[model samples]
Target: MLSEQKCEACSIDAVALNKGERDTLLLELSDWHIIEREGIPQLEKVYKFKNYKQAWAFSNKVSELAEDEFHHPSILLEWGKVTVTWWSHSIKGLHKNDFICASSCDGFVENE
Candidate 1:
C-alpha cells in the first residue's frame, strides 16, 4: 500500500500526478479526502483524540515525521481533533510523496 512507500525529494520540475495516479494511491487512505484549496489539489484527513493532550502529542509525532521525510503538511490542532492537509508545494500540486506522507500518518494512528 501507499503507507509502505517513502517520500522522495521532489524537484521543481516534477510534474503532478494525473487523476488515475492520485486515485490509485488515494484508495489506500480510508479517511482522507481530495480537496482543492486556492486551486491546488490536496489530501486532507481529520484525526480525533480523546483530549487536547492527545491531540497535541499526535501533532508532535507528525512534526517529527514531517522532518524525517523533509515534507511538511498544514496541520490544525484543536481540542480533540487534528486536521492534516498534505500536498506537494514544490510541484504546486499532488505528488506521490503527498500520498505517501498521508498514508504514513494513517499508519501512525494504527500504531497508536
Candidate 2:
C-alpha cells in the first residue's frame, strides 16, 4: 500500500510521525528498522547483492526513484550491499514519506 503512495513535499513545519504511527507504518516494511543517528530517528535497510556491480545498480535505481519522488535518502553502496537511510531532514525525524520510499525500495527487488 505504501508503495502505491507518492511522497509529498515536506515543509519545515511538517510534523514527524509519532511513536504509534511509526510502529504501525513499520509493519508494512518487514526489512526496514528504525535507528537513531545523532539523536535523529531514521528508517534504515541494507539490501544484499551478489557483488559490487549488482549493489551499484540497485543503488542507482534507488537514486532515480528518490529523484522522481523528490524525497532522497542517504545511500551507502558497498561491495555487496547497499544501506539506505531515510528520514525527514527538515523535521529531523521519521516521516510517512520515509516509509513510502522504503516500501518503494522493496518493490524494486521484488520486481527483479
Candidate 3:
C-alpha cells in the first residue's frame, strides 16, 4: 500500500501521455484504461469478466503490484468490473509511478 501522506517526487519526468501512447500501450493490455482526470494523467481501467471471482483475482494481482511499487492507486471492484485509478499519492498529483503502474497493469492484462 502507498503511503498517502508522503510527497516524494519522482525523477522520471511525468507527463500526461497522449492517445498515441495510450493506444500503443493498450495493444498489449486490454483491462486497463488510460485517462486524463482533472487535467492529470490517470489510469482509469475497468477489468471485465464473467463473474466476481475473476474480478477478485485480478484485483489481488493489482494489489500485489501496488504493494511492491509503494505507489498505490484507488481501486473499485464490482461484480464484473474492477476500476483502477493510478496517480502518485505522494506528490498529490501525477508522477512516473502512474506510468510505471500503468505499464505494469498493461503487462498484467497481457499475461492474463
Best by lDDT: 2
Q: Which candidate is the best by TM-score?
A: 2
Model 3 scores what on Cα lDDT?
A: 0.66
TM-score of candidate 2 against the unseen true structure: 0.96
Instruction: Encode model 1's per-residue lDDT on 1-112: one tens digit a residue.
Output: 7867888888758999988988888888787999999999999999999999999999998999999999999999999999999998887789999988888888778998
Q: What is the TM-score of each predicted model, taking all chains together?
A: 0.95, 0.96, 0.65
- Ranking the candidates on TM-score from highest down gives 2, 1, 3
Candidate 2 ranges with C-alpha deviation above 4 Å: none
* Clash count of each predicted structure: 0, 0, 0
Please, what are the lDDT tens digits per residue for candidate 2 over residues 1-112?
8978989888768999998999999999977999999999999999999999999999999999999988889999999999999999889999999999999999988988
* TM-score-best of 1 and 3: 1
Q: Quote the lDDT for 88 in model 1.
A: 89
